[model samples]
Target: MERAGIDGFVYQGPVRVSPIGTHALYEGQARFIQLQFLSFALEDAPNLAGWRQKGMLDGEYGEAFDAFLEITGAVPSEIDDPAVALFMLILDIAINPSRGFPIQIESFENFLIDVDAGIRFVRLCQAARDEKQVLSLITEYSFTQYAEAADILTSSCGYDHPLAVIEHIVEWQEHSPVAKLMEEKRGFTYDLSNIVVRVMSSHFLAFCDDKLSRPEFFCWPGAWMTGARASQDITNLFLKHLSLFTDKADDDGIFPRAIPGVSEENAVKTLTAFYANVINYDLVRQWILSDGPFNYEFGWLTSKHSKEDMTNSTKQAFQHAFGASPDSFTYTWAEVK
Candidate 1:
């Protein structure tokens, strides 16, 4: 909760190295993400380490977690790798904290369900894998506390690839989350689709990036989403943009601007500042300077507006960019008006 020295941009000593400094000091999308994560979590690294240490020693936890939430501005349902990593870290610290972190907290946003669903599903999948020989979903993992996840896995996905199973759910299961979202939001695009895309793609990409994963991980996935091959810088920009930054609260291309407990004032001060530091990293910055004012097929920019408006907007944006320098880049957008 201390100010000044804890800030990521100005933080001296170890925190500033590699976007995330080492305990003392310190390439792939994984590498970039690892560094970027340090930027967000580095400020609280000491607090987290202390919390985990104290929690492990005293068996009481979570008084510091609420403040950590305020400091990190982590929303539980956020599936971005950084937030997910932070969530994983905190989970390890607070799993059995005397009162339990979320359970101890009075707010619903901190509820364990948001983070637990994936854990439950994975455990269920493991159960079903072992159950393949026994032909029953009643393994110790499934029976422990994830009977429902077990049921969903067995009833819907079986023991096949998670991506294939998820796609099957979206495509074939009429009442599935995506299916229902599609039916209800007939003409308009929702952030739900993007969330679905992001979650699945992150899983696939992380799997591919992982060196220790199963041997079969090398096989191509069967997912039908639109995606492009991007270098780590491009991937970092896209991920950081989509995850932490956005155009405007009113933009229909994104979800309603809401990060549960984060106030608009703090959102701007905290999240906006966080995003600025993100793009300023040399690798990410150089790429943006060279090839930014980017457009993707279904990105938020092209997701809205007619072809004429889009074309005009692009022309205007590039016209402004043409005269700009590496120094011209800032957190603010160039006026295209």
Candidate 2:
């Protein structure tokens, strides 16, 4: 349900059934979903002021990576690689906050969902001569199958095995010949866009399929949500809206009749309006100013910013991994002399 993360990586959501029934005549959205894992994690430390005169390969930060793995354990295991672990530990700190456990997240910001197509489809339905025709108009554009995006993984990413991208990154960073190959391939070609995403998505899924199935975990897709969660609680909100617009085969609500009744005219009209407004949120710039905290689905997204206390944590991880501070990798504030 979330899009990009703090590292600026893209996230493709799990396909879910779109209410209004799978589009019968037209193509419907893909509704199947799989949880995903991204390649990096980062946190920032701004309070310590300084600049490094030289890289210290012998520093404590080098071992910090291992310490992290020892704690989280076995398989959110992508961190098993020293290079990835080090990179994640050293990168710029996270500006937005949220839980980062490979499969859990509760907050995010600046997401944008494009609704132009959805809006157009709604209008077409609204213009239908009658309820039945309205259905046809909407179907011409999309199947009732939950609204899959234009870039479904199977169609966009395909089954080809991905290159050993992580290894390649390590090689490139180490001044190996791989860097030249990547530059040449980039050749400023727009078509090469998202090539990394395809590679990582495939890699992540394969990892999850083979590894992350322990009974102790319940996983889902998306990244550190500053506040909003990835849970049935969220899903239920979606379903609530869906039920308002569409009907089910069985009558489960206590009433024999829909409270307002007749999904044909009024309900369909209301749906058209709802479809037009579901844009993604931008928590920072677009957040509505409120007086004090409110309690509800996304009410926790109130804005706040502060640097993390990564002091010993980062170096400790490096120490645990490499048995040293990884001196050259970490910088200290200009010594007070």
Give the best candidate by TM-score.
1
TM-scores for all candidates: the values are 0.20, 0.15
Q: For residues 228-330, could you state the per-residue lDDT of candidate 2 as single tens digits? A: 3344654443332222333234532111123222444443333332222221112111224433222123212111211122333333443554476534433
Q: Candidate 1 on 236-256: residue-level lDDT in tens?
A: 433432343356656644332
Off by over 4 Å in 2: 1-234, 237-309, 328-337
| Cα misplacement distance, residue 258 of candidate 1 (Å) | 3.1
Error of 2 at 59 (Å): 47
Q: What lDDT does each candidate get?
A: 0.33, 0.25
